[model samples]
Target chain A: MSALRLIARDLRLAWTGGGLWLPILFFLAVAILYPFAVGPDAKLLRATGGAMLWIAALLAALLPIERLIRPDWESGFLDQLAVRGWADEAVAALKIAAHWLSFGPPLLLATLVGAALFDLDGDMAGTLLGGLAIATPALAALSVTIAALTARAGGGAAGLMLLPLAIPVLIFGAGSLGPNSVGAMPLLAAVSLGLTVLAPFAAGAAMRALRD
Target chain B: MEQRQAEPAPDAVVIDRLACLRGGRLVFERLDWRIARGTLGLLTGPNGAGKSTLLRIIAGLLRPAAGSIMVEGRVALADERRALDPLPTLRQGLRFWAAMDAQPATATDRVLESLGLAPLADVPVRMLSTGQTKRAVVARALQSGADIMLLDEPMNGLDKASAALMAAALAAQVRAGTTLVLASHIPIGIDPTTTLDMAI
Candidate 1:
């Protein structure tokens, strides 16, 4: 029940704080700007649009990282939760779930615009969406974990640290968008599963360490 | 304020041979204390004397360099930091914790009234003044329903009247069978059953 309340609270905060919209706006901006940069060549746009969308999603995921866990840590929310007999892992897990719920679906939905802008064929768009479905959880996990780790240090350190760690998810997710790389979808899901499983514990340990 | 019949407090918190280290320096060593049921403990110390550190250790937020702490019931801490969300109204922020603590939302009403925050209840927490924010933190600790509360500098930002109200509410909590360990440099106007004074 408490976990549900926390998840609800997180979602509410994300929505009210405009955190959820930032990523979508960023994704759309990237899609919109790409054509201006590369010119209106349909062949070029169709060929690279899916990968650009994937890149946009990855960058958009980074938008929420700095605020994700630091404010809670500074405000002593984490300590209060710990005292309430909520394990750190449980708290981290709930935050990750909330983060995913806030960004993952919206990002998927925004893919329609991405498809239109990028001139992606239906097949490529389907593959891109499928890849994101398998991969966004991993992205959320990575962001949440890095957010916890750099929570006390502050600044853009978390974002810088996150990029390298997220490379595998990006590689697999973007790779799965290729015509011949349909087999990468399962591998992407596998990586996401590993990250989703490991993130809570890693983030929880970092939170505990911050108390010192 | 009416004094209700005192209930027998069932909780006890004991810290033995506790040592704390901060920034590679030992803040304190071999500190021993016990807060038994129905008693108030004042942890008094000068600056840099580890008053807050000891409270954090007791609250299990920080690991003691070497020691054992046995707390028989739920423990809560209200320190210099306000734990409530800044985005929410005072009432909503307090309600979040009350919900987390599995208490009814009405639990916050009594706390709000006690701390004279009833009028400001609808104000966003970020808009609250310093003293009001401090009172809100106290209100949160009071409503926590924890058997043992470790409060660090509980009266830091309060004016005299608000501080007195906080003292009365804390005294009420003790009367209602909650064990309290308050760390404050100023006199809170309530006599503690035991006082642990630390020096640098």
Candidate 2:
């Protein structure tokens, strides 16, 4: 019950804090601006637009990184929850789940509009959606871990820290866009699964380390 | 109220040969204390004397340089930071933790009434003055329903009347069998069964 309540609180915070809109707008802006930059050729836009959306999604994930874990940590909310017998891992897991909820769906929905702007056909759009389904959770997990690590340092440092870690998800997710991309799905799921499994523990440990 | 619905077990806090280090300097060493159920512990020390550090260690927020802490039952801490979300109204902020603690919503109302905060319950925490924020933190600690409470410098910004009100509420908690460990430089106005005085 408390876990649900915590997730609800996080979702509300994310919604009201502009967690949803910023990323969607950023994603759409990239799609809208790309056609002008590269030219009005529909075929070229169709070819590269999916990859561009992946990049935009990756950058959009960075927008919430700074506020994701730090405010609660600094405000003592995490410590308060700790003393209440809520394990850091549970808290980390819930925050990751909530982070994904706040960003993942909206970004996916925005991608449909992005697909239209980029003139992607049915097959490419389907592939883009599948890749995002596996990839965004991984992005959220990596961003959250980085958020925990640099929560105390508090600056663009977390953004810098997140870029390298996020590269794997980006590479695999974008790589999956090819003709034999079915093969890339499992590998994409593998990387996402690995990060998802490791993130809670890693982020939990980072939260504990903040006390020292 | 109603003897706090009975704890799962008798509560106790034991710290042995505790030592603390901050900023590469030894803050204190060889500290020892025990607080049993229904007791009020006063942690008194000069500034920079490690009172807050000891409370943090006891609250499990910090690791002691060397020591052992054995605590029975759930613990809650209230320090300089208000912990409650600043964007929410006082009532809303307190309710978040109340829900987290699995307490009914009325638990928050009871705490607010006790802390003289019912009138300002709709005020956003960020807009609250220092004294009001302190009261809000106390309200949160009281609503936690934990077996043990660790309070660090809880009286720092409270006015005399508010301090007296806080003292009364704490005394009531102690009467209801909640073990309290309070660290403060000012007089807490409640009789403490155990006092740990630290020196720099």
Candidate 3:
């Protein structure tokens, strides 16, 4: 019951604070500009658009990381939560869920714009959306873990730290779109499940360390 | 006081030779104090005397370098930070915590009224002046309904009237069996059961 309220509060704040828009804009900008950068070769756009979208999604995930945990830490909201006897792991897990809710579906919806821009055939677009659906939980998990780690020392290096961790998701998500990749989707889901399960513990430990 | 520490009541906070180290220096050591239930305990010391550190330790937010503290009940804290959401109106910001604390719908208004924040309940938290923000912090701690409140400078930045209101509210809590250990450089307008001078 308390956990649901926490998530609702986070979502309400994210919506009201305009935290959802910047990353969506960044994602769309990448989609809109990719053809301009590489020149409008229709065949090339079809082949590489899925991979480009994956990269754009990964980068877009970073836009909201700085504010994810730092604001609560600075404002002493986390301390109050801690005083309520909330385990850090529980809080982190709920935050991951909230972050994904606020970021993932919107990013997928925005993919329609990207798909149109890239002139992606329906099959490729379907695969990209499916892949993001599976991969976004992992992306949300990774973003939150990094946010908790850097929340105390400062968030300046969160972006730099996030890219390396995002590689596995990118590999499996983008790889699943290849024509001959028979079993890649399951592998992507497996990785996402592991990350989604493990990230809360990692973030929880980081938050405990921050208390000292 | 030392004798009371020797034989602490079950519903009391007993610190036994507590020692704290912060930033590689020993803040305090071999400290002993006992705060019985319903007692108003005051912590007074000059700046850098580790008063805030001691409060955090009691609240279980910090680990002491040595020794132990046994607290009888759940704890809450109200420090310099208001901890309320800045974007929301004061009432909405507090309702979130009220929900978190499992308080009823009426609790937010009740605390706001007690703190004399009823008028500014519609104001965004970020726009509140320092004194109003201080009261809001207390309002939050009050709303938690914790048995023990470890407040750091709860009276700072308050005008005489607000300070008196705060003191009265805190006294009422104490009378109702909520233990309070507050650190303040100035008098909080309540007669404390015991005052621990950290500078010693």
Model number with the top DockQ: 1
How many clashes in each candidate? 0, 0, 0
Ten-residue segment with the worst summed lDDT in candidate 2 chain B? B1-10
Off by over 4 Å in 1: B1-11
User: All candidates' TM-scores?
Assistant: 0.96, 0.95, 0.96
lDDT of 2 by residue, A136-195 (tens): 988888888999998887857887887888788887888888766667878888999999
Which should have the higher lDDT, number 2 or number 3? 3
lDDT of 2 by residue, B1-200 (tens): 45744754344898999888888999988888988787999999889898888888888878888988888788889988888777889999999888888898999999999988999999888999999998888788888899898888878888988999999999999999999999988999889989998866
TM-score of chain B of each: 0.93, 0.93, 0.93
lDDT of 3 by residue, A157-201 (tens): 998888888888999899988988788899999999999999999
Interface root mean square deviation of every model, in Å? 0.8, 1.1, 1.0
For residue B128, model 3's alpha carbon misses the true position, in angstroms, by 0.6
Question: How much does candidate 2 score in TM-score?
Answer: 0.95
- Full-model lDDT for every candidate: 0.88, 0.88, 0.89
Model 1: DockQ vs. true structure: 0.77
Which ranges in model 2 have alpha carbons more than 4 Å from their true place?
A: A180-182, B1-11
